[model samples]
Target: MGICSIKQMTTRKLLVLSTIHQISVLLLSDALTVSETSPDAPNSDDTTSINHPRNLATEALYINQNFRRMVLKRNEEPFKYDNPRLPFDEGDTDADSCVAYKYRSWYLGRQADGTEVRLICRTEHDGVTTGPNGETQMLTIKAFNEWDSRMASGVDWRSKLDTQKGAVLATELQNNSCKLAKWTLQALLAGSDQIKF
Candidate 1:
């Protein structure tokens, strides 16, 4: 009932209000995090399911196909290669007479949320040297996605061959044919919201 009691009451009220404000702020933060689905947002275990290799592969295919469609729609020509003996002459008979060639493809697509996705694939043919019967060769595949200036997931594979077999060397390339696709998908999903065309 005196001044000291009034001051004590005021101080208690202030402390309670502060505690309530802090609790509300924490709850609001949790709510925001749970609701956010953007690439930059923190993800729960469920959200991280997209990071699986299988999901990444599927995403890669989607991005590649979508990009191809975009290119075709724009009437643009994608890169192509048809010759087996390129960067080296068909008549080159030296043991080290190797010719290398690369083929690349790309596409662009917009996500449902309006994010732009870009995908690209590159295949390289190496050691194309002519022998007594035909040409010996090796192949490599590389692909990636670019969200704005940031390069996302990428994949690379090199061919394994027994060079001693010469022309008969049945080129045994460890064909990780899906590496590019997997990498592209990872990149697309990670940068979907952050990347700008």
Candidate 2:
């Protein structure tokens, strides 16, 4: 984001990005909104407080236990959750709304048509979604919290960023080169058709 937003985006890149955005937006999402006004809901006026880390985690658990549902196929089903509880995992289960685990395969192949094909991908994404009509698509949600700053540790971005736009951009190549490359690979491997950022 910092790199892409810092300088001019090519017309071809913009076209491709906007096209993907349009298509992903049209995907059938039975997505749950924080629509109801219950006793436990966050205050409407203090919007920023609602995005707090604690609130987000609580909200995820609330959704995953009952409302969260995703597509799961392939034999990777058996290895859903880890045998031992991971520090970042909560084994939330119980009810028919029990969210199923989806298995992502990383054993990607197909490099050549000569005799044999070989491709090695060390990382894989687990965000695949299947529509009601059996159209498989990967849905990725990319956020922009980092782009609001010049670097990972800088503050006062609102005031300083405007004056140092050129300097900030100059650092993009030095700091974000690998990050940009990784995002490109992720878009290609994880969501070929439904890539969005």
lDDT of each: 0.37, 0.42
Worst 10 residues of 2 by lDDT: 28-37
Residue 194 alpha-carbon offset, candidate 1, angstroms: 30
Residue-level lDDT of model 2, residues 161-190, one tens digit each, is 689866654444344454345556766665
Off by over 4 Å in 2: 1-137, 143-156, 160-174, 194-197
Q: After superposition, how far is residue 126 of candidate 2 from its true place, in Å?
A: 7.4
For every candidate, C-alpha RMSD to the true structure in Å: 22.1, 21.7
Model 2 CA RMSD to the hidden true structure, in angstroms: 21.7
* Candidate 1 weakest lDDT stretch, 10 residues: 148-157
Q: Which numbered prediction scores highest in TM-score against the true structure?
A: 2
- Report the C-alpha displacement of residue 85, candidate 2, in angstroms: 18
